[model samples]
Target: MSHSLQHEPAQGVTPTLRLRPDTGKPNVRLRKQSDGAYRRHPDEIKEDCLSQPSEQIKLDISVADYRVVSKRDSEDTVQRMRESMKDIPRSKRAAEVKCEIIQIIVMPQLVDMRYLQTATDDVIERAVEAHFVYSSIYLIPGLSLAASMCAAFHRDWSWNARGVYYRHYYSPHWITGDHTLWIPTIDHDMFDHPQERPRRERAQRLLRHALDNKRWTKSEYAWEADAWSDVFGQIRDDPALAADKRECYMNMAEVYPVSATLTGKSEMAKRIPDASIGLATFHPQHYQNAIASYELDSERLQALTLHRKTSLISDPRLGESDLVYPFLVYEAKGWSGDPRDARLQACAAGATYLDMLDALARHPGPSGKVEGAYQFAGSRSAQVFALTSFGSHWHIMVGYRRPRLKREHAGHPGMSKTVYLYQRVWSGLISDERKAWELLSLIDQIHEWGVTTFRDYVIRHLRSWHKFGRMVWKGDAERMRAVLGKDAATSGQFIIFSLPSWADGFGTDFKAELRQKSGRLMLKRLIDEQAGEPSITCVQGSCRARGYKCFSPEDFVRHCSSVHDNHSGESGRSVVKEVFDQAASDMKETLQELRANCYEIGPEADTSCAEQAWTMVHDNTCIESPTRYN
Candidate 1:
């Protein structure tokens, strides 16, 4: 039977009920039964439904027959009912049903009342429970009534004890830092250089076109793709913005390891920005030429190629996926997007950029001067600019890691630590003519700083490390001259053998043994060269041209087996066999001592090698454009 009540019927009120349809009963088709004996007879079910008297049964019940109550009264009644239900037996059908409480919190009202109502309705239908059907008018309000109710209930919950009231709040226990200085005031002097006037004028002209054409619509700009490519496309494409060959690259939704959360924290995910401006990727051949000049020993080169080592690459992440020492990051959203989400995303990206700068300064190079190498305003931290926007409103923020301060806390015992800080400097509506030019001028200023100060700091350290490597190479040659005699050591065809990969922190003994073995191999090869019997390349079934010409003889062996060997010698080529064996042995032993630890001194010389090598890959790679506009 079907009956409706808010909680319970009022005193002396008797509500009429009606039998449910036979089709609504549970199906017996899938049940396991012995010869169908457990199933109820169809006639018995039909007779029971028909036994209800016509006068007592109400077939069509409507809301007009029941008393409607306010939401507060309804909530009070539900609480009373819940208390009353506790006394009922556990076996009762009423006590067996479980109810799930779903709360539908609404956003604060905006200028467009209808838009707010529609968005709330869409969220209720799609984001909330989707399977249930409601019959009462209170549960499902009509459009006109819903709009008025939404406006009446509009209240601002923007501020909370922890931080801004975004959908997700950072947990205090998990997130440690002072976010009190959340937003910073804009400093006009930061971007007020005399050279920015022409670029600002150009930005004004392009922005005027976008607004006048009305090319950005609410529907068309529902996603960020249109906002980036159409509305702001001109700003990035402007020749003046990229005058130093630095350009913005879209890195939408690509996760960066630098932004990973602390252990046991599930509140924050890895940071992925919409875009960033940095040293742009160049042609493949230029990259090859640059890496070819690095002349790294075999172990470091293999680790680099496999992306197992990121120290030499100056990449903040495990692999070399992002620009080295990028300076600016961005996050964007369309008309229907949430501004808080955009702000949070921008903060995360900006923090990651700042963290990379910190890493560059902290990484220890062989020269020992690499530590604390990047300092701005006497601090090791560097500033990173962030641009975040939702719809026509845009904001500029500067992110950096504040130095930790020594202080006492009553509640906690440790010293005060500071997390990455992303402080908003300026924000305004892009539709305003004056604001657009000011924002674009700030971008130009940021671009200049990125290519000059930040670029110079990174390049300086990389070049220093490369020069140190050259010194180490020279020292190795001198030591070889003393040990293997000048003629053999200065031979134009000496091999550069590769040492096996060793674990970090505990390979001192093994490293020393390898160095001694490397020296012994060079001495033995010098003795073999004293005979000088025309070398094995002149023999049959060999490559038959000259001595080995590569740093790795294993590669040469593969070259000979594929190009010269006919497989027809069949054990008759003993000299060729000996030559291949000696070449393969030489590939793993010669000149490996050159890559020994920087602490290992040379023979009567302080020529410690480059334990970790760094190079200026960007120097030989990036090609600049010849023209500049403005």
Candidate 2:
């Protein structure tokens, strides 16, 4: 019977589309009975004939030929592997060279996702969509996402130092020409102060114990946590010191990477060091007290924060993120670690720290003085030290930037370029007892320099920068323009007045102006229109001193009255009239000059002179007055 699903006509009927099986066809087979053989047998063969393969042939390859083929394939694989290893370094160099100009797109959404542990494909797609939406909603002029097809590239100015295959390779040559520029010139006497003798002895004893134990050999962490910890204790303060104490100098291990502190061209691994030590952030009470001591308002605390944010004035970290005002850093390696790599890391970290101090000195304040107020070595030069260690050997290195020459005039030569140097000042082997004692003594001296010299230098410069900012903010319109340059036009609004010293403080009653000293001065009342509260300028004819502003009406009135005419009787009255006439004449001339300079003011003005003064004063925050430092 046929086994088709279709109905058949009958048992003997033939199908139209299907063929019948042929029973006489040949069956070719491979049989392995005792010996391997391929045979073609007749369709009707019996089981007894299976062992007698009448037509058969053996078909098999030798093991030696298989081995030869396998060896040939393996050699090809090895050759490819060899080629890949040789091309890897060349590929890296080519990539770095191509990145001479890097294009960066900083989307807030993508940045927020950086710390996420895991994310799905859909989540990433959503984040990208969010970034596009954000960019579309917050469009900035000249930076439109939709405007132009042209691509923008930001030049990697330090690209030379970024590539390992490049000649510079982020080494000392990139910073300074002479490798030995500062090494031989280090003042050895600076580390031998008499006050450090007691601590030196203590550090010596701790160092000896650390060296003899051999406990640190267990691991790199053991070296840092145990051996190094004990000696550093004598070099710094007790670990028990309150975090808020001003003199709470201590060591911190492995601070989180601060990308802001990276110097030169690259934001690479070298920017981070193993350890850092410096003054702890002062207690809020101490900060306020210091401000009070300087006779400044408590609100002035914002200046310090701003300074730290804009420049490396203090430690790169803001608020309460581990260490503050770090002056020393440690870069270490294990027993088998390469010393050169440690030194390079130290060089990068130290250069960044010193760069901050250099920034402050380079910023000539409103008084047009640079580094004139610094008390140690010289004002222009800044130096920060580091400790680079590999196993038992350690070196004390100093990163120094020479004092930049003051521009004799506006066009001085060699004033535009700055150089930085990294040099090893001292070295020691902890295994040697004498060298260990010397190392401990140097550590104490370095810490002393941090508290005394480093602290004072930072404080002094901060004072100068802050005081100069306040001076420019409150000074006359002329001085404001001089210091702020083009920013003075838009940063604030101003109006000039030639009112006599007796005009009762620009229309307001003298007593009222004094009573409301902290109040904002309105320019609309003076100009007889809806003018915004522009800064009020009162000029003194030919006085070289910065003229006063009506924002501080009390000071302006006292300045005009007392400074112009201090004599008694009719003679004083005559002198006052002459000064008043001269002031009026000077005011008219100054008004024309301001107009020519396009000092925009009036109803559309957004910031008033009083507002500008407050902002500038707060921006450059300092705890002490600059005069005290000078």
Quote the lDDT for 232 in model 1.
45
TM-scores for the candidates:
0.39, 0.41
**Candidate 1 residue runs with Cα over 4 Å from true position:** 1-201, 209-216, 219-272, 281-318, 363-379, 403-418, 465-630
lDDT of each: 0.39, 0.41
Question: Which pairs clash (backbone N, Cα, C closer than 3 Å) in model 1?
Answer: none
Query: What digit string (tens of lDDT, one per residue) describes model 1 on residues 1-630?
Result: 987766887889998898867997666654322111112322212222222223221212222331122344457778998887787787794557677643333333222313433454344223211111011011110111222332332111111101111111122222234222222233556445667566556656646644543344453234345445543455456322221212322122221111111112122233556766554333334445432223222322223222212234333232232344556667766545555556655555555556555644543343223344442333353667767665556667665565432111111111113344344466565655556666666665565565556565555444444444333333343333322334644443332233422222225684455455455544444553332211223222442322333223244344456666634243435544555455434422332422332322235333223222111111111110100111
Identify the candidate with maximal lDDT: 2
Q: Give me candidate 1's TM-score against the actual structure.
A: 0.39
**lDDT minimum window of 10 residues, candidate 1:** 132-141
Top candidate by TM-score:
2
lDDT of 2 by residue, 129-161 (tens): 333222211101112121111011111111101
RMSD of 1: 26.1
